[model samples]
Target: MTEPRTFTLRDDLKLALELADAADAISRARFTALDLVVTTKPDRTPVTDADQAVERAIRTVLAEQRPGDGILGEEFGTAGSTSRQWIIDPIDGTAGFMRGIPIWATLIALAVDGVPVVGVVSAPALGKRWWASAGAGAWSSDERTPNASPTRLAVSGVDTLAEASISYGSLQQWDQAGHLDEIVSLSRQVWRTRAYGDMWSYMLLAEGHLDMAGEFDLQPYDMAALAPIVQEAGGVFTSIDGKPGPWHGSALATNGLLHDATLAVLNPA
Candidate 1:
């Protein structure tokens, strides 16, 4: 019997980067031409259109390139096999994108049997892209400096909450989750706190600019692309309760040294 062919981490990472490129092309154009004059009542038309368009573009490419792989996308939901799936959030911060904020990004991740092994986050509006695969260190590049080499990312060395800088996505989310008191308590212990919000906070944590980040009410599409990058950058990515993987409905990312301490604070009996 012949053995099944296997793909390398680098190969998957390259495909993920290509997927991000296609996604950025569609998302950036829509965001640039967004009609801010239209009703601002959180109408889903613009973002929903962009989201579906980007996902379709990515799915087309994947269908041709990796016919055997499964896909889980925000706009389209799940398809194909669950063993080796691609999780996608065509635009990670739709509200920000719709509002002409440049913090939105396309998130792509490859999960084999539910564990993400590769991740790519492309924020074209911000002129930045970050990516990683297992064993390969997390890295980022700036379109503003086209010729510059990609920089390897690393989380900070801060080991204590008292010295760490942290970000939580929103006070309202915490309050709604009934964890507002814990968040407030954590902020008091941290050296600094900000509600940078969305995927940017976790990206900042991976880049070592922030020591920790956590949030409630997240989906796998919102977090799968981030887990590998944070993990490869020498950080910890888990639920606020400390369970591994993006299956949990919430997230807590920190410099590895502070994960346990932060989890304790958020989950005290």
Candidate 2:
């Protein structure tokens, strides 16, 4: 396929939002439906008819509008050029979604080369959507505030772990990764801790409602959309081991002021 003309980050962000809208239309309708088919992937993760349908919807649009860009999706594997790939987790919390929980989301990201420049996360069951582009501030909307404007997001200013509230996706994940002790120890030092699980933890962190969030056993699609939103909201996103980008298998995110402190605790010498 011939490369499409270059697009600005803002343009990509706009298209990402459109993709999210299409995804929500499919996913929201299927959520909790009695006829919804659920299956287990080779990795033992739950996948539903809704998950595959949502990815197909997004990919269909991307194929028509951004055919030059490649896609790395949870349901459908990669295709096209990586230079301007779109990373997607059609349903980031499929387990919760399959169980009728309102915590799942469709995560979409436009990564130029390897760094995400645009991201959108839409959780229709929760009645919220958030997005950001590099150089554009993060913003979110809620169905409760239908008449109001989108709110600009910024991370909390808590500068110490003792003053910070944090979320760790799942204790099981940490234990499986051999970092259970580290997360538990760090939890004791924080003002509060919750195992919110999946994309919600990171999105809450981006909204400044939570000061830090970390987890292990993540794929690039799981964290790619999140890192951009968190970073644009004045927070930091990196691997638990302190590397940048979602290529790393784990994630550690914090309000900018507390990143080093959190890292030191997690990586105590």
Candidate 3:
């Protein structure tokens, strides 16, 4: 058996971006065609054919380019080595995608030994892409300004919850989690609140447009890509309970200044 070749973080990030390009080609085409076949999953969430196709495209590229790497994708289950895994949400907001909403994106992340080191969130419909590798600053490019250089990203300096603008997924999600009251209290404390939802909220937080974002009932693929971008942008990302990484099934991303304060509000001990 051939040994797996190790890659630098930048090299892996480049490959991730290429994978995003592959995903975008399929996702964007399907989004425009509007020939979607949606079905309810066991969990009662909708999944579209485009989601499967985008993931399959990414997996095919990984099979040829990084055969030894593992994959944990939304459409297909896990495969290969856990030590170096590519976590993907081929279409992070399938509900939005199915409804022709342009908030969806393809999320790709390379996590080494459970720590995400590189991430790419490509939203072709939104005409934007964001990426970062650990130690390299977060960056984004706009399709509207294709000729311009990628701009670096940073989180806001809003230090107090009274001054912080917070975004979340949905009121229903939090209510279902029995935390609706907490989120309501949080809304009262924050300067502003919006249900930007999906991957856009975290990307906005990373860009310093928002101070904080949190949501419940997330899979690793849903968060793996966003975490690195937020962290590289001088923010912090953790489970709502304050545990690090994407394994915790929920997410709370902030400007680092308000993580503890927000955590106290959401998961008070």
Clash counts for the predictions, in order: 0, 0, 0
Tell me which residue pairs clash in candidate 2: none
Candidate 1 off by > 4 Å:
1-5, 34-46
lDDT of the structure predicted as candidate 2 = 0.93
Q: Which candidate gets the maximum lDDT versus the true structure?
A: 3
TM-score of predicted structure 1: 0.94
- Write model 3 residue lDDT over 184-244, tens digit each, in one string: 9899998899999899999999999999999999999999999999999999999988999
**How close to the true structure is residue 82 of candidate 3, measured as C-alpha lDDT?**
59
Worst 10 residues of 2 by lDDT: 2-11
Q: What alpha-carbon RMSD in Å does predicted model 2 have with respect to the real structure?
A: 1.4
Of the two candidates 1 and 3, the one with more favorable TM-score, higher being better, is 3
How well is each residue in 212-268 modelled by candidate 1, as lDDT tens digits? Answer: 999998999999999999999999999999999999999999999999899989999
Model 3's TM-score against the true structure = 0.97
